[model samples]
Target: MRIRLARPEDSAALLRIYAQYIHSPVTFEYALPTEPEFAARIGRISETYPYLVCEENGGISGYAYAHRQAEREAYQWNAELSVYLDAAAASRGRGTRLYRMLLDILPLQGVRSAYALVTLPNAASERLHASLGFRTMGVQSEAGFKAGAWHDVAWFVKDIAPHDAAPRPLLPVSRLDADVLRRILDTRG
Candidate 1:
């Protein structure tokens, strides 16, 4: 598997993987975004945070990204995390590999806390988050209505790095040094 920064051109392949969850109660999304819309989102988020993909034999197998947790300035150091994998790629340790690189890269961009929300009853997702040190904060009971039923969301949080009194200005992913970024991708532990 190859892990690298996501590009706008990956929108289509990424969308295909994401579509797997759209119809299920695992995700609240009821409709798939248009290709252009997904492309725009990829371009916008990678500007300041890590948006990465794992490719197997030239095909996108899975992807993970961090987006603003909230609009308030105080939440700048915190981000919401999400990941999706191709059906064939599930349970093969690819998600772990993608997340390891993602979590490693975030600290360099000044991320202090990372959050994830898993729709209730997803044992695999919850297990993955737990393996990565994410602690359950709480659960939103029936927080969203989807697929003819209300679903709950379990929130988990992980500290990416030390939260100091004063944080250095966030470094955009584009400005990250190539060698440093390479080391992150090559990290196995």
Candidate 2:
């Protein structure tokens, strides 16, 4: 498996992986985004954060990304993460590997905290987050209504960097040292 930065052109393939979850509680989104919309999302988020894809056997098997947790200036150092894998890729450790790379990259971008929201009863996702050192902060009861029922969301957080009193300004993913970013993407588990 190889991990790399995602590109706008990858929208179709990535969407294929994401579409599988639209009918389930795995994600709160009710519809699959159009290719252009999805590509725009990749472009916008990649401007300041990490958006990555995992390629296995020449096909995209999964993806993961981080975006601002909140728009407030004070929240610049915090980010929310999401990961999705092709059905064929589940249970093979690809999600863990993709998230590991994402977690590793965030600190370099000056992200202090990484948060994730997992819909209730998603044992696999909950286990994945816990194994990565995220603690369950709380649960939002009936956070969203989908698939004809209400589903709760569990909030998980992990400190990716030291919370200094005066933290340095965030370094956009585009500004990270190429050599350093390359090394992170090339790392193997």
Candidate 3:
């Protein structure tokens, strides 16, 4: 199997893997809205980096990607990421491989920190992230309402790089020199 960057053409396969979570009994009962505006969202986020997949036998079996942590300038360099594998593709190491590739790329992209919030206590995911050096940031006690009840969320985090790395500039950001801004904005390049 090989790990590679996801292309715009890969969105359909990415969505397929994502849909499994959206439909799973564990996930759906306390269902959260996914990309309701996929078109607009895809148009924007597909332009970023660390959006990747693991492919084998000529098909994508798993995927991982990062996006803006929030809309605030202070959140730059801190990304929110997700990773998923096709249930049929589990136990074959696709999820671990995909996440490794993403973590390897994130710091190079100036990502100082990365975070994940999981509704269920996924031992595999927790183990995988822990292997990649993430730590238990904290959990939100009974923080989410899914299906018909309350659920807890665990937030895991990793410092991808030293805090000494310069902060990413603000949007409409004059903070970065033109060259620096060019690199961050042109992730796919």
Candidate 4:
């Protein structure tokens, strides 16, 4: 399996894999995309956020991405991460390969830390992040509701790099910045 930057052509497969997370067992309530919206988002997101996917035998098997953890400029240095692996791809090492690639590359692009909010009691998801160096950021029981069920959300975080002790002003050089990523994606077309 190979982990690489996601391409425009790979969006369909990426969407399919993410949609799997909304099904039973996971029971996530987010609505899956309609065909038209799916195409538009793939074209939109793959450019800026450093979205990535894992492929084996020429088919995408897993995907991940990073986005602003908060909207304010003061929160610029931190980002949230999302990783979803196709069930068929899990336990076969695909998720690990893909996430490692993302973690390694994103920090250099200006990401200081990446946070993940997983539904509570999700050992598999929690363990995956822990093994990757993420520490628990605690859990909020019944923080969200989906499909008429209350779900606990666990927050896990990992710092990508060691920053200087000085509290520096947010700048492009301090980290590539999400805005920079936004610009990069715009250039992909």
Q: Which candidate is the best by lDDT?
A: 2
TM-score per model over all chains = 0.96, 0.98, 0.77, 0.79
Question: Candidate 4, which segments miss by more than 4 Å at Cα?
Answer: 24-29, 165-189
What would the per-residue lDDT of candidate 4 be over residues 42-134, giving only the tens digit for each residue? 556554456676767788888777767888976666767777888887887666665676666566555678888888777788888989999
For each candidate, what is the lDDT? 0.89, 0.94, 0.67, 0.69
lDDT of 1: 0.89
**lDDT for position 78 in model 2:** 97
Clashing pairs in 2: none
Model 4: per-residue Cα lDDT at residue 141? 82
Candidate 3 or 2, higher lDDT: 2
Deviation (Å) of 48 in candidate 4:
3.2
Best by TM-score: 2
User: For model 2, how does the per-residue alpha-carbon lDDT over 1-189 read when each residue is reduced to its tens digit?
Assistant: 889999999999999999999999999899999999999999999999999999989899999999999999999999999999999999899989889988999999899999999999998999999999999999999999999999999999999999989998889999999999999999843
Ranking by lDDT: 2, 1, 4, 3
Q: 91-110 in candidate 1: lDDT tens per residue?
A: 99988887888788888889
The reply for model 2, stretches above 4 Å from the true place, is none
What TM-score does prediction 3 earn? Answer: 0.77
Give me the runs in candidate 1 sitting further than 4 Å from their true place: none
